[model samples]
Target: MNDSLTFCKAIEALAANIWPAEITAYLDNWQLRATRGVTKRANSVLAIGEYPQLANWLPHIEQFYADNSLPAIFHISDASPPGLDALLDSHGYALGTPSLVMIANSQDAAAAAAQKLVKRDVAALTAEWVTEADEEWLDAFLRLESYHEELKESYKGICERISDAKGFVKIRKGKHIIAVGTAVVQGEWAGFLNVVVSEAERGQGLGSYLMQALTAWSREHGAARQYLQVVASNTAAVSLYEKLGYQTKYGYHYRIKYDLRPLATS
Candidate 1:
């Protein structure tokens, strides 16, 4: 009923709704074969907040699969409150990698971009843009995310959604696609998701170019603000984003835990 609880509930709901249907159902009630929008098997972990006890949810989680069969995995951050981790660990879950959550308000961003990088005319991107994605683009996208886990279909789904949806943009150099980004519209705020630049293309200011292009796209789509997340240890990226007008609004971290121990494969 209070403002804080209301906001927390809203955040949980947004996180849940964005996942695939099977994931939502599995987390919501531990059902199987129940596919939801974009969520697929390799991408099945769903985060729930303000929910029932973890002990009660363990059966459903375990029933789905063992360690190797983990259809989906999620890093359960202490975002909920005390004792959540204890309950999860007691059930044989292991902590996973963590990432920092970041946000920016358009009201503060609408002003001239700070430390201007030579503006590339966002429209220039359209000239070199090919299909929303191609085999080469997909390969590069996967390489950037090789550090973490992700479902093949999950990326495909995201690409499908962005391709058909308005307000998505990409920029390329010759046959090589250099930059990509998407802005998910939520009320007055646009969640900037999956901004990636090829490793070979780094330091050329493509990052800032994509940021400005995405920010401009967000504004055109009626978004009043923009936000995105990066790993806490990624100092270089955080510094660049700060220079681009983003301030730390909040942070979310996750650790993956399992319900069963890993079996020897030998």
Candidate 2:
């Protein structure tokens, strides 16, 4: 393989190991899992390397589920063997919504320094700021959702977590929230998510201001990098992030349909 592809593959492997822990830390609390033989929606076995024994692995996978009394879910990607899809189909494992695997680097100084916009005099969001369980937050999110529906539920979850946890920031005006965002510390890396601005407040630079605020906070907390995901199709967001000094370290593809539920038998 070429050096660039090899380096990317190495990073993907590292991320595969590191990210699963991050997801499990949170998902294990509310999400369900079953170990029964690779049927789906149970124990999710992720493969980041070669897959040699296609046929023999099934019984072992089934045994893993049957032994644990849980359903078995195998997460595979295009990097895997071509036979994986057919094997899963023959074994009755259903597929789930695909996830985008995006990455970013914070070490680029020019990009970070290029973000020179001045912030407005809006109030900072705090634990007490979102105490009312208000609809204003939900409303702003719904407006954003109109443009990207996949974010609707995810934004709700982030808002709820920020309301209950630390690392969330906001700017409000007289009981109305103009902008909101949340950040999380992961070693030397800080991740940003759930940034939203009111529909009426868009052109006023609230979105950019919140971004600068989040970046400043992440830097202050000793983070050497900041990362986030924007839907591949959102040109506006891609432009904004590019202007702010974020580079596309990689891209992940995804597809979704709202009407149909996943089936293990398929």
TM-score, one value per model: 0.72, 0.54
Tens-place lDDT digits, model 2, residues 1-266: 55745544554443332222212211211222332222221235554345644445545544443455445555555444447656666645555544333445555532443344444443443212343224555565455545454444434443443321226565665666567766665556666656676677666556666776666666667777767655667666666677766777654331211212232121
lDDT of 1 by residue, 1-266 (tens): 55755554454444333322433344443223323212232244444454445545655554454533553344343335457567666655565545555667775554435345645443334313334555555565566655223455555555554422334455666655667765656666676666787677687667777777777767766878666767778888888788777876455554344334442122
Model 1 spans with C-alpha error above 4 angstroms: 1-5, 15-23, 26-45, 53-55, 65-68, 75-81, 110-114, 118-140, 143-154, 161-167, 258-266
| Top candidate, metric TM-score | 1
C-alpha root-mean-square deviation, candidate 2: 8.0
Assess each prediction's global lDDT (C-alpha) against the native: 0.54, 0.49
Per-residue lDDT of 165 in model 1: 32
Following a full C-alpha superposition, what root-mean-square deviation does model 1 have from the true structure?
5.4
Pairs of residues clashing in candidate 2: 34-42, 34-70, 34-71, 35-65, 35-70, 35-71, 36-65, 36-70, 37-62, 125-170
> Native-vs-model 2 lDDT?
0.49
